[model samples]
Target: MARRPRLEPRETRLDATQAYLGRAADLAAEFAAGIPPRRIRTFSEAAPDDLRTALAILSEIPDLGLVVHGPRGCAVRAPGVAPLAVTDLDQRDTVLGSGEVLAETVRALDAAYAVTAIAVLGSPVIAINSDDIRATVATLGLELDKPVVWVRTEGFRSAVPATGGDAAADALLQLVDAEETEREPGLLNLLTSTRGPELAALARQIEGLGWQVNILPAGASVADIARAGRAEASLVLAPDLLDLFAEGLETRFGVTRLDVALPLGAQATTAVLRRVAALGGAAAPPAPPRSVSKPLAGRRIALALPTSWGLATAELIGDLGGDVAALSVPHLDRSHAAALASLAERWPDLQIHVGEGQGFERTGFLRRNALDLLLGASDAVAGALRQGLPAAVLDPARLIGAGAAEAVTAAVDSAFARLALARSAAQNARPGYTPGWLKRSPDWHIKQEVR
Candidate 1:
């Protein structure tokens, strides 16, 4: 009797499980043991600590209301976003658990809005008091028709800010049905932040290839999320924030996720569209044509962005004939090792600053190096400008497609032309830190931690 042919093992892509948070230097170092341990200033408005990150994620979900299960201060609102109902636990309520307050708030929010889902978020006060968020949500769910999700977002628990977003995504995934359905051949679930002009352009690109794009959580309704299992596959626009949600979708409904770099530059955008088109069994459309009025040749740029975005931005800068002189990443993890390696190969001598609020270090670096431009978040851009350097805030929206590429080129040219004006303003403006103090070792404030 002939033995049955050996079954081939199916290839599995690296999902969010293998990810881990660490200092940027440790991540970039060839040997982790050889690297010096240091605690850099690790806070920024872009992140604003982990609690804010969780709140921000929940706020983006359309028609989903939030209940901050803590004191009035914990009920911090994200500007122009979702409505939040706070428990407003006081000293008396803290002594005797705020369960009643939570219950009342949930009921009030349920009556106030026609929300499809309600997220009950735990703040530091409630977390410390050991408030039973799960129990409260379960009890409330019995009376309410809408699904209630408990998001654990205690500020001190998570070291990496993105974990807060992960928790929010996990809670959102609870709303998705477990049972699989007939897959929609030309439907793609775009796991991203929200609907914007950039996202619209990306949707159009996919639509051009005969595929329909579903923006999750952002503009997605409860019905859309419930039927997410039917999509052909999920594509992560901002993997750092949405990879966990994508992984959850795949696990629950057999939906595959295309884990690729964001569609920032020409190469990355083309690669994204090609992979998406292939996944949906649609014909890949011709790459959009780009015309650069002024190429970034011989220009040196420094970037301050998250790892994934920074890597893609570096590639875009390179494609436009500019050099990524230095970059600052919020946190580095194992999940980014492959991309980091690729970047290292391209720029062997790239300078990487780890953590945030390193204005002193950034100022010193800009003054020391012959940098042409600084591209980063608002704070970083302002810091660069105050140092008499040409700078532009790195807008994620301006990194989508050919039109985005042109926009970036135009922004760079504009910043370069305004260098003299920026320098004059810097001379007149009151300095935040003295040049002498900034001249100290870039790691002057960083304390080494031996683990």
Candidate 2:
């Protein structure tokens, strides 16, 4: 008997078992309708990478109005962008979580920065129990009569710098907007699971709904998140941060959330836009052809990132107008299982290549297939480009909506377009290839290229 050739999904169809439950479907529907998007920012220990990322993000703030806490070492040099005051946490308090020290730091920071809100970063010895440390900050915020949020994240080694900005951005949303922001009349928060450049496009889609967007740490301020209370609603674009934010925000502010897979393809983007419009109590806009759901008769693509990005990336590609070529996630942990299962069920014929630390085989597979587009680690992308394939890096900072989606979409489209224009340029120059050390395993690969 002859074996059947691989079959890619027609568009995207999950088995009955994969369909969302009542509430899940309802929320997903609402998200497609249109809801208010929240603003976010991060607070955590000041690791080197964290500091660098913080500086990179903070520097972009026209007026650096952030309030920081920690020791003198807590402050990193933000070139050309400055003008914010940072409180030094000092040596003793660094290892030891001290209310007194934090109180003092908050007082100084509040007095100096007198800015919108405050968020904490991890530092020194306090890294231990950093998860619970936000409560301490809450107490301080209440005392200082300040709006402050604390972010807790593990430091990324130079070998693989984690997506600190994305994580930090997640925390920022929790800190500032969790309390004050009332859902706007009609808008949605584009919560992304994987941080990458494509965020810009997603944000633009939300804006198309006619609601205000506050992109937390990346494009929002303390004042913006505080305004969430007035927004129409919120939407979750990314899965990882979805549950965490959805549950917390729903309980705290009675804000409803529409949790859906990341909208990557034309179909998915259109569906997402419809959901956003519905939630806004308006007719869904005439979605552009480039939107995920349209014009994707049948195309194939590859998903090559850490395990963290596999499911989300696949969803995006399938939604747009493509099929999976290869799947390369860093590990085969539980997080990967759900994502893999989702894609596998949806696209039974597609090859879901799981890369468990064996970079050579995975790289070689991508090189050979040279799928339509590569979405994963920089190295894997480079491998594809080496074979004269088209590739684009994922950047989370670009995801923080704030009406940046059009530019982001243009960038993604242009990047892919350029691959055709300068196939030789990327191949010979190898400009897109990121070293293994720089690539964040799974979750952070999209933005590592920017680092």
Candidate 3:
């Protein structure tokens, strides 16, 4: 068992380190060189799409409005759960400038919603035109009483989708008052995306310890985000997604961070609860013995999931008698290095693929490997199912606590039970891709450089 690092107050930028964490140094090196075996599809979401993620995070706060300063299409992407407005920019505005339109949009949102705070998000069009959204918001702030924050969402400039989330966090932190306050003991900021049953289950576990859980981003109010500075510490659930956000909070608010593996499966989850309890000065509850199911014995499983979930799910699958044949992570960075190293220690021979939209490579792997189960994101599951493989979409948020583990066990058993039916459907359906083409090297499309 890996010993947990002691929590310490420090001033450091987490993103200053490499993001990709993997035991296989060679594979990480290959990905860094941009010569992975297969080319993947480009992510369609621009930076503004992060508004969906940002709004989801901010949704916990009541009556907070988001003003998207771009085309109407941009506003359409914003989840309907929150009050939103769009600048409705067109060709004329793009050629000229949309500053006036943005000011009008903010004014309209202010009049329309009784929100405590409003976030102004820039779209790809604004980024392309290099519109000074910050300046516009600043000019409006001079007159508007409510705080107006500008979140940079320049999707065309970066490939990483989470960059927009980081931008939102940074902008949101600006709204947080820096004045020191008496630290609230046993108060923790749970920096993660938790929804539905998982949120309820995890909340019970944390609250059961007599500690207050403040879930950030998801469902967090503007006040909750601002008050995060007053928490005893911040516990990160999705380190890969929120490490930079946590770092920002720590730097600006003096709130220390507990960087631990995501709570998945019996052991990892136990570790998380115990650590948080200890940090909150509560007694650590005795962990129940883990129950392993033998249904997956002798089975090979492949995973395509977010970084933290991918690592934790691998452990759960292993406990359930499944051997992880391969794993696909969206992206790797410095935040993931420790987890990657830990995974490497456990599965030295594991094949790790890092990229977004690597359906081609996944298909190729499914063709070559005698995999019994394919668990991953919806796109990956669809690709595997088309190839007649029994697959399940791994929604990490939905898979929490021991109940979630059991649910996954049941899901695997059910998928295997219906394997024949899935196979028959695949056989009857028109094949999406030719077998010969799939059998070809994933690098087939690439022109090799000769020395």
Best-fitting candidate, scored by lDDT:
1
lDDT of 1: 0.71
Tens digit of lDDT per residue, candidate 1, span 1-451?
Answer: 2332221110012211111123334345642333223343433223365667777767876588888877888766765267688888898777667787889999998899888888888877865577778887887887896688778675365546667767777777777766657787778898877567888888888888888878887767766787777887898877777787898789878788887778876656888899987876777767766645338888888888866788777777777888888877765555666677676777867777755555666666666667888887888888888878888776776677656567677778778888986798689877867768776766555553345
**Per-model TM-score versus the true fold:** 0.86, 0.55, 0.84
Off by over 4 Å in 3: 1-25, 28-62, 290-294, 434-439, 443-451
Q: Which of 1 and 3 is ahead in TM-score?
A: 1
Residue-level lDDT tens digits of model 2 in 318-400? 65555665665432323234555566567755554432334444554555454566655566666566656666665433433
Candidate 1: residue 355 lDDT (0-100): 57
- Cα misplacement distance, residue 219 of candidate 3 (Å): 1.7
- What count of clashes does model 1 give? 0
Instruction: Report residue 183 deviation for candidate 2 (angstroms).
Output: 6.6
For candidate 3, the lDDT comes to 0.68
139: Cα error in model 3, Å? 2.3
